[model samples]
Target: MTSLVVPPSTLGSSFFSWFASSSSNNSLNPPKIFRKTPSNAVALYPISLKSSNRPSFDRFPRTKIWATLGEKDPNGAAPLQVVEESSSSIVDEEVEKSVKVLKDAAKTRRVAAEEVLSALSVLEKAKLDPSKFFNTLGGTSSPGRTWMLIFTAEKKLEKGRYFPLTAIQRFDAAGKRIENGVFLGPIGSLTFEGRMSWKNRILAFIFERIRIKFGPLEPLEISLGKKDEREPSSKDPFFIWFYVDEELAVARGRSGGTAFWCRCRRVNT
Candidate 1:
């Protein structure tokens, strides 16, 4: 069960409530809510940071991280910060933060863990159908559990496909980040490393797993679908497509010799 809120015009599309598994210990504090900005592209916003504010998609980072408040909710957070991919060019604020955090990943895994989990929760609330995600927290040495992101492309138990995931860096025996995974998503399971920002301003992902043929370049940065913009017909099978420069790039999946798109819909129950 999830919650739906009215679309805040300041943002773009409607907002979705974040729900955590009952097993979670944090409850006294409210979970963050993400909004989808449908400015011909996808960007997320956080409710607490809402104002008569907006951001330009052209200036954001390819992948970045921002922090929200634990004070009842995220506050003074970038709400809409820029992401910088050029790790060496440290010219952007978002880039500087990403570098600092990734550098201290050993001591900051606890923080990164929570940030990514918040993202996972938002995606779940968005009700991305036919897809389900779960995260295991035991770092590299946790024996049965290793720190990994798992998403089931076609989640029905009857039949489907599950992708393998890896972070931007491999974990050392001490669970410190080395070399930087930077492109975490679907490694054979990543590259599609994107999420609704704390400000609900950008929902982005990458597609660069080489297995079959169908697309260009190893990694392609693309926008995501907004809430209302995703009026997927419940009665009809929905085909998920990645937006390339604001245009829909239908993603096709292959089985045996034939290729077809994955059928899906918003799990709005």
Candidate 2:
């Protein structure tokens, strides 16, 4: 992330000032940062996660509102409860987390672009939907912004069930990348329960929403692309099998030219 960081002294304004201004305006915005596209930059895709154990989430963890049983209600299943926690406090915490991470990812620290991608994969794998709640990294097209659109769609539960996902593309002043989106099918908004983070990202989100919830060591894997020679045309972009190191996992096995199980790695989950 050394490449992502910028020195405060070099800016015409204060570090926190830039953050407050930029983050306040750009949260949840699309890829709008002006970037220098690396000449060697190729097709970068997220490593799809496939695990035998399905992931689950809790939408509301703190506020508890159970239906008080009365003679008037007699049913095998009680209705879902709606607990209204102070939304502002949760929003504040999320904004703070977004600011902190944005600062780190946008810094000249050694976390670098790859680290940004890694952190993003974690969120993607867990099926977190940032759009449902706060989008602190929002922005519009900038003067010379370069962007990448990642369209991910697939069924998660039943054959007809699919997760709607969205992620923004981010490039620091130096063209390093940082961005993430989520699986959006839940009702209501998302809440930031906080996180477990290290110096340069590499965090596990502890959040809740109307549909699902996930947390640390979420049984995920990161893939290092493995090339497949077969292609409709040699000139066409060939497919790569992704594997997460130090873990045994399979996403969408190498059928139809997309393989998930051949190789995998531990995501510190």
- Best prediction by lDDT: 2
Assess every candidate by TM-score.
Answer: 0.16, 0.20
Which window of ten consecutive residues has the lowest lDDT sum in model 1?
Answer: 256-265
Candidate 2's C-alpha runs over 4 A off are: 1-62, 65-95, 111-145, 148-269
The TM-score measured for candidate 1 stands at 0.16
**lDDT by residue (tens digit), candidate 1, 3-85:** 11111122222111001111223121222321122222111222221111111122333445444444322433353533334
How many backbone clashes can be found in candidate 1?
A: 23
TM-score winner among the candidates? 2
lDDT, candidate 2, 69-124, per-residue tens: 43232344445533444444453344334223323432222334344343333333
